[model samples]
Target: MSISRLHIERVRNIQTAALHQLQPFNVFYGQNGSGKTSLLEAIHILATGRSFRTHIPKNYIQTQQADALIFAQAHQEKMGIQKFATGEQLIKVNGDSIATQGQLARLLPLQLIDPQSTDLIDNGAKPRRQLLDWLMFHVEPDFYHAWQYYARALKQRNTLLKTKRQPTLADLEPWNQMLAEYGELLHSQRLSVLQQWQTFFLHDLQMLLPEIAVQIDYRAGFHPELGLANELQHAHSKDVERRYTEYGPHRADLRFKTALGDADVVLSRGQKKLLVMALKLSQIAMLHASNKETVVLLDDLTAELDSTAQRRLIERLSQLGSQVFLTTLDHVAVQQHLNDLSISYQLFNVDKGQIHAVEPTIYN
Candidate 1:
């Protein structure tokens, strides 16, 4: 679904802004510190109940403000979020209060491509695992509940390991059973999604990085032969030594590899960025194939990619029917590219804590 209206309040430099009649492509342009990124952050907060900029609410919420508010309408459904400085949040859909963020996420699936997106390749496993789980959460209907169960069980098991120095098998049996049950379910769901995602990923790789041969690998975080139950039983001693559960789906990772070595190690900085783009764009394509449209948040469109790459990226996104919100410093450059492709878009010029829509110029 695409957002038609967006409202923001008390968010970073943006004290208050209301945008209406958003098109398939919405471009925000301004100088540094012009609150353009904050506009995208507001929508990210509304979709996921958090900010991509900072984890702390006080950093993104305007100084001295009690909370930041974001609201949007997609068709007849309305979603809103209020994030307090004290780390409390209230999410609502269609004017009714909601308990979980998944409800909002299921309605509005967002794919974010920012300066930090390369962290997926350069950083450790958590971000990569999160990327995989985000796909599972969207495409797999039962993934969220299974993940909830596995996380709860994993937490209990870890707490037990920390508290009891010599807990016997019987002491950990119940939690282990729960973990194995849910963890195995999560593994199956993730494996199925990953297999399908790899197909789409390879196609995008060809289009975006044809010269590079990259392989996506999945580590299940457990012994494939022994299974989670058997592995947990075998790792009891190691678990006590480390004071945490070591092996399970919780530790799963996705490794990007090439003929020479890992993608991060073998590829240059620019190449790594393109690889990350392929990963995210492939995900959008996969979801689109299933008739689920994704809202893409692209921060600094021109900075991360060259002119040719930007044109290809925009063309791919347009072909997939994604509603895009992008930020850039050069409006003329971005507008020129969009005009050359004959793509319809709405432009908004952002200033210090304020935003104004710029009427589009017709080009023949």
Candidate 2:
């Protein structure tokens, strides 16, 4: 669903703002600190009930502001959000209260590409797991509950391990059983998702980054020989000593290998960016197949891409029939580049925390 109208209040530097009649291809161009990126962040917050820029939702509210509110009308369905400075956020979809982020995700699925996206390949395993889990959450119906159950059980087991009075086998048995059952379920589901991705995503990845020979492999978080239950049993003493569950889906990670060796040891910064972009695009493709029109948020869309690469990525996105929100600080260069590519797009000008729709001719 594309947002036709958006209302933002007390977010970042924008005390109040509204953008109406939003289009499929929306561009926000302005000088630094004009709040261009904040607009995209607001849109992201509305979609995910979380900000891509910061983990702390409270920090998104303007300084001295007690709360922030965002309301969006898309595809004739209304979604409203009230995020308090106290770390509480409320969501109402179509006038009905929503408590689950999954519910909001089902309504507004989006893919984001930004400077930090390279972390998908360059950083630790958490980001890769997050990327894959987002895909699984959308495609697999039972994934969310299974994941939720597994997390709760893991927390309980960790707490038990940390108790001053050591937990007996009987005390740990129930959580271990729950963790094993759900962990295997997660393992099965993750493996299934990876198989499906391999069916077409490999080819799709090639299309995005032809020169990079990066490979993706999944580690199921436990030794295949020992299995989850046995691994948990064997690690019990160490887990108690460490005060946390160590060998389960929580430790799952996606390993990146390349023709030269491990990707981190071989691929350049630019190659890693392109590889991550391909992986994200493939994920969006899988979702778009059924969702029809996934909203794409591209921050600094041309940041690491050359002119040719920029043209390719934008055109590829357009072919998916997706709505794209893009930001660029170098308006003249970006405008000229898009003009050279010969595509029509809407431009919004941001200045001093205010944004207004600008006529296309303003570029001329």
Candidate 3:
């Protein structure tokens, strides 16, 4: 699925904006703080109903504004029938509908690769886990609901552990069972997706960065004698001290390794960015393989990437049979790699939160 049009108001620096009739590839060029990233964030909000950049909706509202609004139209072809999807999503502050956005995630799977993507390797485990969870949420229909239940159960279990001190095994047994059941199920689902990706997309990723041998490891309370239940029991004293559950799937993490070394240590700035790009590419390939069309959103596409890696990325993205939205500051950054490419793209020039489409003749 692809977005045919997008309308925005009171979002960030963009007071009112409407972009329609998108091409397969779009390039948004602007100086820093000119609302370029906000455009991408609006698209992401429409797709996931949440801002990938900020947690606070108020931040999305322009300073001193009450709310923000986003509107989008999506197109899809299914069973040889073309269909249009439309919706109105709203975010209200103080009981008023000031801003709104919505998205068709399943029909419109989007892989957003941004400058922050480098953090997937250089930072904590949450981003890496998110990579797995996002894929699982889209591929396995049941995973989302199960994950929701597991999170609620886990929170309740932690609360129980916190309030009640010196609780016996019998008191905690029920929550333990629930945690173990859901935790194991979540782990298995993630492993299944990773295996499929490794089998099909890993090779294509290797082609992007030929030197590194990438590996994904899933560890979810997977130790003998100290399983999920045992770990909980073992950490009982610490849980009481900290007033929270210390371990479980919530504590689980993924480890990425390469033939040269661990991703955390040996990968350079450019290498880490390449690793993340490769992972996103793998996701795009997997989605295409399942016969799902997607829209790719990328911000700061030139950062931390050398010419060779950028070329490889463009090639992989082109082969996925999907529309792509890319934002960058320097036209020269894309000109070297995308020059003479026959793919269709619309160019937009952004200035001070205002955007206008630039004709192809400008490049000529």
User: lDDT of each model, Cα atoms only?
Assistant: 0.92, 0.83, 0.73
Residue lDDT tens for model 3, 1-364:
7777778877788988888888887889999999999988877776666688877777686777665666666654211110112222444322334332211456558788998888888888788878877778777777877787779878887787777877667777788788777777777787788789876557775777777788877766445346676777787677767877778767667778877778889888777777788787887788888887778888987777766777777767888887888888875657556665666778899898898998753333
Clashes of each: 0, 0, 7
User: What TM-score do all the candidates reach, one by one?
Assistant: 0.98, 0.95, 0.87
The model with the greatest lDDT is: 1
- Estimate, for each residue in 1-364, the C-alpha lDDT of model 2 and write its tens digit: 7778889998999888988888777888888889988988988888888898788877889998889999989987999888888889899999999888678888888889887887888789898899889889889999999999999999999999888466666788899999999999999999998888765567666887777666688998898677888888888788877888899998899988877898877887887777777787778777777764678888887677787667777777776767888998756666665566566667899898898888765344
* Segments in model 2 whose C-alpha atoms lie over 4 Å from true places: 336-344, 362-364
Q: Give the TM-score of candidate 2.
A: 0.95
Error of 1 at 278 (Å): 0.7
In candidate 3, which residue pairs get closer than 3 Å at backbone N, Cα or C atoms, i.e. clash? Answer: 46-102, 68-99, 69-100, 89-100, 89-101, 90-100, 91-99
lDDT of 1: 0.92
On TM-score, the stronger of 1 and 3 is 1
Worst 10 residues of 1 by lDDT: 355-364
